[model samples]
Target: MPLGTLDRDPPPFFRQGPSALSKLAVCSALAFFLMVADARFKVMQPLRVVLATVLYPAQWLAMRPVLVFQHASQYFSSLTAAQTAQQEVLRKHSLQSQRANQVEQLSLENERLRKALGLRERLQSPSVAAQVIYDAADPYSRKVIIDKGMADKIALGSPVLDESGVLGQVTRVYPLVSEVTLITDRDHAIPVLNTRTGARGVAFGDVSLHVDAMELRFMAANADVAEGDLLTTSGVDGVYPPGLPVARIEKIERRVDAVFARIYCVPLAMVAGAGHVLVLEPTNAQIPARPAADVPAVVPRRGASR
Candidate 1:
């Protein structure tokens, strides 16, 4: 027989325990008794407390990295949320500001239109209403373009006006638009009458001041002109209507050696950024020619010199 088939047993002298089944039964009974004793008499309570106290430091140390990672994640999340909220608030504030500005601009525009309409109605002139298209291309001259042109009966030398006074006169007329020369242009002049002292003078546009101003040229240095005086069209020029507003006396300067007073006036009309205006028919156009019998002599034409 093989050696593996023989019984493997310890010598009696060396044997010191019972069979495996008996040993298992004895261990189970001792475990059950210990459990009962712990439950009823609290025998292991002190040992458990001592073990927890001893292991607390190790437990805290083992969880340190997890706690740190959780806290970091929460901090980053909170920062991101705050930034997003701030951006949203800024966007809303900007939108409101733009809306408020638009509303204010619209209100001002509407007020101007209303005043212009009232002025137009009060004047009994044959006029055509037109809107400003844009400013003229000339940088050195104060001029603007209107939407009306020859097609709309806008003629040369026609007076244009805004709410307050004569803004300008139509200078160039195209098929669909017309160019207006403002009263502030250097080449423009208007005959004005002072309402206070009943004085007549010619107001020429002044470019030397670099401001939108006009000067009463050729007036005596000690003239009766005063500040705050109102100037209106004298109706003698056969262009602007009588009693129409032109400008107001803003400043007057009299020099010892000068022959004329350096009087500056501010135009009553909205010369800059005018939206709506009126184009009036030229006053000379409406006047009839003199009778042929009243002519002193009929001058021969230059081409008839042959």
Candidate 2:
């Protein structure tokens, strides 16, 4: 009775014609031939298109199950993720709507302020919205290039700004793009004033950090400058608008040996972190036209090198 089960014959296993390795080899050879023929002979074009079209739906359908399962697992894994995603979308929409509203309000307010201050009507600086393409390729340089350029009405010396405050001015203009110099460059200096005390000073920058923080040079040792003082544009440079935020006095260092107090200032505007910027094209009234007499004329001198 026990031997009866063992006595039953095993079911016949189906035998494939070729071994798996052999079949794989044959398939690889055929694929190579097809690729060579299509690339070299320009044949199999129609066949490739036909095969792709036929298999596309099947391939997509097969992937749907895996993708659906993965998404379903993710959805169930964490409620915070779903909430975060929803919050992100809502925040984005809210910001965009707020920005739109602000644009309208600014336009109306700018018009009224311009009229009230007798500021010349800006000729509408023809501008194109541009995105910051990338940071400066040279780590030592604090500069950036924007997608917009001369082709888009961007010009040298055109002031760039963000919603918060002034960023920088365009230094170079190319056909398809433009380069901007950040206020953080070692050579780039801004005339700033202590907003609270109305004390004025020039802020100098260090190019290494690529931020607008600068040292207040030549401030007297007995100067009333202190930490937390808000620095703003004094309008002496004529490049930046008066009262525009520049930086904050973060710290002050004074010693008997040093002639001036070493003060570090942090820029109010985050130029590096901004995605979009506004280009302010100076109006005729904003910048006074230089008279021919006042403009320096070059005169050829006999002693000068040719």
What would the per-residue lDDT of candidate 1 be over residues 1-306, giving only the tens digit for each residue?
Answer: 999998789778777779889999999999999899999999989999999999999999999999999999999999999999999999999999999999998898788889888888887678998999899887999999999998998889999998889998999999999999999999999999999999999998887775788888889998999999999999899998889999999989999999998999999998887888999998998889877786487779988965
Instruction: Put down candidate 2 lDDT per residue, 216-272, tens digits, no spaces.
Output: 888988899889999887877656667767788888889998889888877766666
What is each predicted model's overall lDDT from 0 to 1? 0.91, 0.75
Q: Estimate each model's TM-score.
A: 0.76, 0.52
TM-score (C-alpha) between model 1 and the true structure:
0.76
Error of 2 at 260 (Å): 1.0
Whole-model lDDT, candidate 1? Answer: 0.91
